[model samples]
Target chain A: MTEKLRIVQMGLGPIGNKVTQYLAERPNLEIVGAIDTDPAKVGQDVGVLAGLAPLGVIVTADIDAALGGGRADVVVLTTASSMAKVHDQLLRILPYGVSVVSSCEELSYPWQTQPELAASIDRAAKKSNAAVLATGVNPGFLMDFLPAAMTGVCRKVRKVTVERIQDATFRRIPFQKKIGAGLTVEEFYKKVEEGVLRHVGLTESMHLIAARLGWQLDKTEDIITPIIAERRVTTDSMVIEAGNVLGVQQLGRGIMGGEEVISLVFRAAIGEPGARDRIVIDGEPAIDSCINGGVNGDVATCAILVNAIPVVAKARPGLRTMADIEPITCW
Target chain B: MTEKLRIVQMGLGPIGNKVTQYLAERPNLEIVGAIDTDPAKVGQDVGVLAGLAPLGVIVTADIDAALGGGRADVVVLTTASSMAKVHDQLLRILPYGVSVVSSCEELSYPWQTQPELAASIDRAAKKSNAAVLATGVNPGFLMDFLPAAMTGVCRKVRKVTVERIQDATFRRIPFQKKIGAGLTVEEFYKKVEEGVLRHVGLTESMHLIAARLGWQLDKTEDIITPIIAERRVTTDSMVIEAGNVLGVQQLGRGIMGGEEVISLVFRAAIGEPGARDRIVIDGEPAIDSCINGGVNGDVATCAILVNAIPVVAKARPGLRTMADIEPITCW
Candidate 1:
């Protein structure tokens, strides 16, 4: 019998729970360890924490103990949003020689934003002979990878634009709150200036597309603005009055030689008319594609993380970006 | 300095000419030889044949001379529409240790139609340590590869359907004539029965999708029907009277355990309201995607061939299908 690939779940948040639940059902993948810092979750059954039947494996906070057995081949890390917050944790895990697939938005293309930390991670991964990749739906796949793949049909690509719109009212409470769904416009601007409200990774996506196209971008910009509610909007946990901020409208652009070569627009708001993901490539024989209903973020993020495990395991050992790896597939 | 990848272009048909034109402009790719059977094109400049300025390389009809010098690393073959017609050509090239990327539609997944020939090609490729791949925009990318890639976002895929519609009036005269654009309905049916008309790769696309998803199909079917012209239509050289055939509507389906798991529909006619490509997956969190303004076949086929040259060169030695190779990318 062939040995199943062993996977360690390193976080127990909503997305992490989704990943664990999905991975538990795959016959070829075995969940070997579960780790989290929360006191309540540290001693719970991993399966139960994932809202599934108990699989007999217990969650623990000890990273070294979980990895010391050498049974774990890959770690699905969803503990943080930024690479800075997860840098030390990666340092702790890479030495075990286990590959990692994380959901860190900033880590998706860290070389563009955190060059020093990206190099450090690369060095550590190389020392351990383990490959590392960061990916998610918005920043990694839909807005970046998909656009780059579409350009495969073009003989000469002059411009690429991607637009993603989602109705946040159907999302979870944390996601709703992250978008400042019930805040006043004044407060929304305050949070935006405080660097706590805007969406992350738009600029990272821009840089990624530019690099894939071999364009040396002279300028890259990301701007965020509030999407105000036109009428009363209510979700299961929150209510937004008219004139209050509904969500965010963010745009990122990469300029090269005075031309906007890459552009990404993301909108997550309440009561949007017709949510979809669209990409337009301008060149010889232009292309325009749209997904009538955009991909579900929570589910897609987990699916990509799980699907990427086998890919990362086969990748070259080091810190890798999506562009550096093979085109992602069902395997 | 790194050595450029050497490429040999075979068959200077409409698509082959486009491939040569695109490959000539790439800095990382160098055109080493061009081959065509036409007496008029045998000694002409390859660039002029491609409607471009002179590229110093002349067209040749000598296959041995092209491969004997070891200057060619890959051959882009666009000679025929079926593997049976191109099998000997592939055998000749593979033994030279030069990888091949062909546009033969039936070769896309020959295990379904020509298993014997497929295995022979595989053995030849393995013995020579050379890889062989057959790909085009329709069978290789838009229908099979793209749909398979979209499933990476799903935890479970129950059914997959792809719809591609093209406006044939924009295509070249040969393509327009191939679709029986000026033929009557009776003539179209006769041509279809005679195997002179209809799309070639829908069944291949179905098999490719099934292989990727690991589904054992119990039954597969391909159906063809004429799209009657609603009104009089005229192209650059021909005209179709009202009540005549506009083009062909082809459908292919794969069934497993009495359930239709894979479905493909393609429509290319003289006049259509909208020309786009759409895919729908019925599974957890269903997905609907549409490419508004479908991919241009001529341009995309050339782009895919040129882009796949490097991939085929680096692939495992065998008769590899699109599903067997790494995810198709711009590289």
Candidate 2:
């Protein structure tokens, strides 16, 4: 909107790579730099890394340099949701009063889930008088905006529930490992004991929704057990043994005032076939929407962040979470 | 299991009264005592309050005597979810090592949403070597159990959404007031400001869900506004002003990892007709269930609580939420 905005893209992961591709053609947007921990590819041409045309952009871990020297106008982070590291990178640009948009789950329930990290980000954002916005597809768009938008069709609501099912064999490799793709039940239990193997994004989505909606989600719970395929299967190049590879299934439920209001479920594996999502509303003029596959989740989330840059840029600067405002429209 | 389990029913509200009636003639359960805040009904017989045969159970607000001096084995709390003070009552019954279950939303998210209260109650329960469980119809049965059971059907999944809607004019009074039924847009906003009116519940549901499912919901938001009637209508007792006295529609969404996994929405109002709820899953073996609202969710939550006592009573300690234990049979 203002003479071709400069932006920094973080992480060279699948979504990050996809984001670069999406942003490549936008005349008003320019990639000043890129960040990733892939040591082998550091200092490599980001355009080639993102599978796009030559843009002269290089992937580097030098977040500070990317923030300063007028390297970029805004920082677009698509890193891990725990991205407390993003907070540090965000600070370097904040003092310059630069705006930041991220696909970080940490920003949603920053206080309750990550209080210290959230407080630090908040302090830095306020001190620099720069704007910060966190959003993404699953945690950003559908969880927060789709439901809010659905209220338009109903007259009265007694309860609301959200259900999502995903098959991640089509997703990138890292996601497969992250969700425990080739693990036995015994190994899965071991990982659970160590508290490291599991899905990572949906929890933040719930936080964003609750804060905006003003319902007190008093209790939440999830049951995670790896789902190994009943039959042997193989992926693009990998052979998933009959019971060696995980046919993962994860389901989480939430209760408010002793009543269950929401459920978050995900399943991913190497040989899984397809994916689907559905929503049902129980009011006058009841509504239901069921769709197939991932359906622009992360892409939509990227759009939400890019579109909301203007809104955050206009609003007051501070450590703002979903609780501080509504599931606003970027338009 | 133990001679019709002497059960003490608390808060003789509409829900409490209905649950008492629902279980009135059951041979395995007995109403031993009752509690309420109303002074007028303080000494009245519980059976007479529900217009049933006299069981000689008297209602009182004195929680101490109600559970102290070796009284009932378990206390069924159906008090208002807004009463944070009542949660403290949950801790008192435990010193006698008396197991307790409540329909309190506060107890559901006591640790995350209301940590201080959850901690204090946790300490109280620890001192008493007792266990506590909370649940209800929507947040309890449908949101928590139905989805958990649906896990058996899916081999792989990507996202999930749940929905519930009910007409409030057909519902009881407390629900209408709490959901801000029959109000204009300006009036609804005013109530949200007053903190006296709210959609109630979903927040805790989302919170518990994220924690239990092992995904980190870093950001969440709610989309709620006013729902005016499209046309003029009249209810059994209340007059409609065309666009007034209809009800409010609400939605809450939770997303994880840049993908929308859980989408929850519902409708509820009294001025209209009947109430209904449904669950729709999106996996290879998808699920769909629509239930009529005859279960009386308010009281059914209490039933959910009482029903869970069997499993929770035997569960390990240290702040165990719903997913921590196996699903107990209440049907």
The best candidate by TM-score is 1
DockQ of 1: 0.52
Off by over 4 Å in 1: A1-3, A119-129, A230-236, B1-3, B119-130, B230-236, B313-320, B324-331
Instruction: List, residue by residue over B225-263, the lDDT tens digit for candidate 1.
Output: 888877788777778899998888899989999999888
lDDT of each: 0.86, 0.62
Candidate 1 C-alpha lDDT tens digits along A1-331 = 1568899999899999999988998877999999999999998999999999998889999999899979899999999987888889999999999999999999999887899999999999999999999998877888888887777667788999999999887788888889888999999999999999977889888888887676789999898999998889877888899999889999898899999888898999877777999888887669888987789988888988998888788778888887667556554
Give TM per candidate. 0.93, 0.49
Error of 1 at B100 (Å): 2.9
Off by over 4 Å in 2: A1-331, B152-157, B173-178, B255-260, B270-276, B282-299
TM-score of the candidate numbered 2? 0.49
After the best TM-score superposition of candidate 1, give how far the Cα of residue B179 lies from its true spot, in angstroms: 1.2
Query: Which ten contiguous residues of candidate 2 chain A have the minimum total lDDT?
Result: A322-331
User: For candidate 1 chain B, which ten residues in a row score worst on lDDT?
Assistant: B322-331
DockQ of each: 0.52, 0.02
